[model samples]
Target: MSGIYIHVPFCKQACHYCDFHFSTSLQYVDEMTDAICTEIIMKKDRITDQVGSIYFGGGTPSILPQKSFEKIFNTLTTHFSVASDAEITIETNPDDLDAKKIAILRQLPVNRFSIGIQSFFNEDLIWMNRAHNAAEADSCIMRSQDAGFENLSIDLIYGYPLLTDEKWHSNIRKAIGLQVPHLSAYSLTVEPRTALAAAIKKGKQVPVNDEQSAAQFISLIEKSGMAGFDHYEISNFSLPGKHAVHNTNYWRGIPYLGIGPSAHGFNGNTRYLNIANNAKYMTQIAAGKLAETVEELDIYDRFNEYVMTSLRTMWGTDLSKIERDFGKEFLNDTIENSETFIRRNWLENKNGTLTLTQDGKLFADYIASELFLIDEQK
Candidate 1:
């Protein structure tokens, strides 16, 4: 079984630090939805597996015009073999949720709400140019609960210039105290071509400090551990049984189909992404072309992807699974490359699993790269 992801690429406004493909212009909303539904039908035969989860993610999926949401959901139901108990998640920003709106969403098959609460501080939200305020952050969750939606996830952005260490702890406490089942926390990064990057370039915003980000991440780990939520992935924490089944499947290399502009699809050895331009995507899909670029994953590519993703999770790299999937040569090369980190007490191999120590996680990407089997240039 696989999952289906729909990217709603319209946001009320762009966050200063976000570089995701989205547009503030609302002119193409109807056209985009129609294109997405058409894309779904055209790709149905391409995806043969049953969809275990259906996720609406993006530039604030909650911002979808109510009728647009209805159309997309109805189209999915018509075309896909979605499971009755499937985990349906919708990514919404706080400002988009109100009592009446939450009630309407509750009427749908969506069982989970993933709210973008980047920060609970009004000033930080303003600095990031988010659409919601601090009050909206608290109110949205309570309103959803009041509307009888129990499965809730909140996202937090830590390690910004103004996010002090104490404040970071407070933010985590806010989620924990709310009894929210899942928390997706990320360290702020100034992506290229983003407003945050421009602000820093103009000397109006402070550059991100690696040391500060590291400290704040450590704070997140400690507090989440204390709260009994497993730091399951690099940037996600969940109470027992609260880990997002949809995302866990992705990390496990399960196949999924993504529909909408800039959406990505992974089917068997091939990976494809649709054009990021909204108008271009709609026009091409309307003309019967998928407007996607495809790539085939070779042995080295698969091994490297395995290393990068597994190392970010608490599960780490399973030597047995590696030997099974990639071959003994790949597994041996991985262990040999990890020796230096092992000696430094950063990585430890025990019971056939190479897991990271808390300290080692601070430089996860670099460490994973050292073990990457980047094939020789040919």
Candidate 2:
């Protein structure tokens, strides 16, 4: 079984740090929904297996009207073999999840809610220009649980200028205290072309401190572990048996279909990236065409990608599988390259599986890059 991901490209407002393709204006939401459903049909043959997971990510999937969701779901059921026990999720915001909204969602197949509760602090939310207030962030969770949506996850951001070590600790504690099954926390990054980046360039905002991020990341790992949450992936934590199936499949290199403007789909050997422009995407779909570009992965690309993604998970990378699939030469080179990190206690090669040690996860990117089979090296 594979996964299906739909990217909703509309938002109520812009977060200062967000660089994902989205529009603040929502006048064309219905048209966008139509295009999304059309895209889903157009790519029907892409996945022949039953869809075990369906993720609605966004701009803000919560903002869509029930009719729009119904229309899309109708199209999906008509075309795809969605599993009986599919883990259908919708990425939502607290402000949009009113009792009325929750009731509407209950009527649909949405079983999981990934809420965007970046902070419980009003000041911090205002700084980020998020739509919801502190009160909404706190109440929405309780409300959803009371409404019987227990398969839940919430997002939190740390390492920003307004977040002190004390505040960072508080944020982690608050999420755990909420008793939700899963949590996704990320250190604030200054993406180029974002408002946060522009502010830093103009000296209007203080630059993000790498040391602060590292310290807070360490704190997050320690605190969450104490609460009995598994540090399953680089940025995700979950209680036992609560790992996100869709995202876990992604890390495992399972193929999934991506729908909507700016969405991406990956088969085992190639990637499909859709156009980011809203009007252009709609026009192309209306013309019975897909606004997508395809990239076929060469052997080196596939090997390097596997290293990058698998190294971030708790299961680690399997050297035996590498040799079986890519060849003995690749496996030999990998072992030779990993010797330095293994000696430093940053990597562990136990039972033919290479995993990042606690200290090693901090340098995950660097380590993976060093292990990559670049064309020059090939």
lDDT winner among the candidates? 2
Candidate 1 C-alpha lDDT tens digits along 115-154: 9998889998998898999999999988888888889999
lDDT of 2 by residue, 131-231 (tens): 99999999999999999999999999988999998988888888888898899999899999999999999999999999998899989999999999999
Candidate 2 backbone collisions, by pair: none
Give the CA lDDT, 0 to 100, for residue 63 in model 1: 83
- Distance (Å) between predicted and true CA of 34, model 1? 0.7
What C-alpha lDDT, on a 0 to 100 scale, does residue 30 get in candidate 2? 90
Backbone clashes in each candidate structure, one number apiece?
0, 0
What Cα-based lDDT does every candidate model obtain? Answer: 0.89, 0.94
Decoy 1 TM-score against native: 0.98
The candidate maximizing TM-score is 2
